[model samples]
Structures are given as C-alpha cells and as structure tokens.
Target: MKEPRPDEWRAAFAREFQEQSAARFEKIGKQLQFKLARITAEPLPAELHELFKKKEKALD
Candidate 1:
C-alpha cells in the first residue's frame, strides 16, 4: 500500500477537531440542564417576562 500524502494525514486532525466540538456542546447541554433543574420558580416579574418574550421574538 502507498503511504498517505500530508493532506490525508491532516484529515485525521480535522475529524478530531469536530469530535472535540461535539463533546463540548454535549457537556454544556448537560451543565445547563443541571443548572436549570435546580432553579426554583417564583413568579417572574411582568417586565422581565416581557423582555424575555421580546428576546425570543427577535431570535425567531
């Protein structure tokens, strides 16, 4: 078999970068889930709720 060219060797690094990115996102999701679960809900103030709605609408 022929040896891989430099680009072929570099392709493994690209796949590793993507795998690392996916791991980071999964970790963040788990952490956010844990944090949000611990929040006890009190009545959200109306102004804050309105601001949250506006932010949601802007994202949409």
Candidate 2:
C-alpha cells in the first residue's frame, strides 16, 4: 500500500486528537457529576449550602 499524503495524515491526526479530547472531557464530566451527586446526597454545612446557593444564583 502507498503511504498517506501529507494532508491525509494531518486530517487523520486531527480527527484522532479531537476524538481523544472529547472522550477525556466526557470522562471528566461524568466524574464531576458523580462527585457532586455524592456530596449532595449527604448533609452539608449551612455555610457551604449558602455559598453554593449564592454561586448558583450568580450563574443564573
């Protein structure tokens, strides 16, 4: 088989990089969700709950 052209190689590399980046981001997001769910399931300090509410309100 013939070697891939320069453009073809570049395109392949870019596609692979994007796929890997997306997978990594997805994994991180899932981990963050799991941690947040765990934290929310337990009783939190009143100060922390207030802080979280403020932060969430600011985001809205």
Candidate 3:
C-alpha cells in the first residue's frame, strides 16, 4: 500500500480528535445534567447553595 501523504495523515488525526472530543464532551454533558438534576431536587442550606453559586460563577 502507498504511504499516506502528510496532509492526509493530518486530516485523519484532526477528524479522530474531533470525534473523540465530541464524544467526551457529550458524556460530560450528560453527567452534568444528572448531577444538576440531583442537586436541584435535594434542598440545600442557604449557606451551601450560596457557595455553589459562587463556585459556578467563578468557573464561568
């Protein structure tokens, strides 16, 4: 078989990276949704809730 050109190899690498990144982000998003649901469902103390809000804002 012929060797893959540099550009073709790069393109393949980029496509694979994109696919993996997308899959990882999708999984993370689903997990975040589940965690958010659980957190929202359970009532939190005012102090703890305020801490969470601050932490989230910091991340943003």
Candidate 4:
C-alpha cells in the first residue's frame, strides 16, 4: 500500500475543515432562525424585543 503524500494529506485536511465549517454554519443559521422566530411570536416588552432584534441582526 502507498502512503499519502504531504500535499495529499494537506488537501484532505483542508477539505475536511471546509465541510465541518459549512455544517457548523448551517447549524448555527437554523438555530438563529428558530430563536428569532420564537422571539417574534412571543409577546414581550418593547425594549426587550428590540434588543433581540438587534442581536439577530448582529448575528447576520
């Protein structure tokens, strides 16, 4: 059996990193969407709602 070259190992590592990062970002986006929707649906004081809105925007 042949061993992987350094460049091959580096390419594989980079590919894995990119896939993990994409998955992580996708999960985060879903979570943020759910949280924002829940916040919008629930009733709250004006100030707190605005605070959440700002946070949501900041995450974007």
Candidate 5:
C-alpha cells in the first residue's frame, strides 16, 4: 500500500487529538460534578465562602 500523504497524516492526527481532548474534558467534567456533589453535602469552610464572595464581587 502507498504511504499516507502529509495532508492525510495531518487530518488523521487532528482527528485523534480532537477525540482525546473531548474525552479528557468529559472526564474532567464528570470529576467536577462528583466533587461538587460531595462539597454540597457538607458545610463549606468560612474561608471558601469568603473567597467565593470575593470572586462574585470581582465578576460584578
């Protein structure tokens, strides 16, 4: 069989990279959701609450 052309190789690499990035983001999203659930189950520390308020003010 003939070897793949440069463009074909680039396309294949791009597709693989996209798939890997999507999968990684999906995993990170799930992990964040799990952590959020756990955090919500307990009382947040005062420092974190203050930090969140500061961030909110910064956003506004």
Candidate 6:
C-alpha cells in the first residue's frame, strides 16, 4: 500500500476539519433557535415583558 503525500494528507485534514466545524456550528445554531422559540412562546414576567416592549418601542 502506498502512503499519501504530505500535501494530499494536509488537504484531506483541512476538508475534514471544515466539515466538523460546520456541523458543530449548525448544532449550536439549532439549539439556540429552539431555546429562543421556547422563551418567546411562553408568557414573560411582567418586568421582562415591559422591558422588551420598551426596547421594541425604542427601535421603532
């Protein structure tokens, strides 16, 4: 069996690293979206709700 050249090995390593990083980022993004959806779907505490409303008004 022939060993891979150094450049070939480096390219393969880089491709694998990018794939793993993208997968990790996607997993984190999904978790954040789920958490945000849960928080927004439920009733908020009065103070927090009021604070968000004020922030929203400021943005408008």
Whole-model lDDT values for every prediction: 0.91, 0.98, 0.98, 0.98, 0.98, 0.97
Please give the lDDT score at residue 27 for candidate 1: 100
Which pairs, if any, clash in model 6? none
Error of 5 at 6 (Å): 0.4
Please name the candidate that would achieve the greatest TM-score relative to the true structure: 3
- For residues 1-52, write the lDDT of model 4, one tens digit per residue: 9999999999999999999999999999999999999998988999998999
Cα lDDT tens digits for candidate 6, 1-60: 999999999999999999999999999999999999999899979999899999999999
lDDT of 3: 0.98
* Candidate 3 deviation (Cα RMSD): 9.2
Residue 9 miss distance in model 6 (angstroms): 0.7
- The worst-scoring run of ten residues by lDDT in candidate 4 lies at 40-49
Off by over 4 Å in 5: 44-60
Regions of model 3 farther than 4 Å from truth? 46-60
Against the true structure, candidate 5 reaches a TM-score of: 0.70
Clashes of 5: 0
Give every collision pair in model 2. Answer: none
- Residue 10 alpha-carbon offset, candidate 3, angstroms: 0.2
TM-score of 6: 0.70
Q: Write down the RMSD of candidate 6 (Cα, Å).
A: 4.7
lDDT of 5: 0.98
Which residue ranges in model 4 land beyond 4 Å of their true spot? 46-60
In the range 1-60, model 5's lDDT, one tens digit per residue, is 999999999999999999999999999999999999998899889999999999999999
lDDT of 6 at 31: 100
Question: Candidate 4, clashing residue pairs?
Answer: none
Please estimate how well model 1 matches the true structure, expressed as its whole-model Cα lDDT. Answer: 0.91
lDDT of 1 by residue, 1-60 (tens): 999999988998899999999999999999998888767445688999999999999999
Can you give the lDDT of residue 26 in candidate 6?
100
lDDT string, candidate 3, 9-47, tens digits: 999999999999999999999999999999989988999
- Model 3 residue 4 CA deviation (Å) reads 0.6
TM-score of each candidate structure, all chains considered together: 0.56, 0.67, 0.70, 0.70, 0.70, 0.70
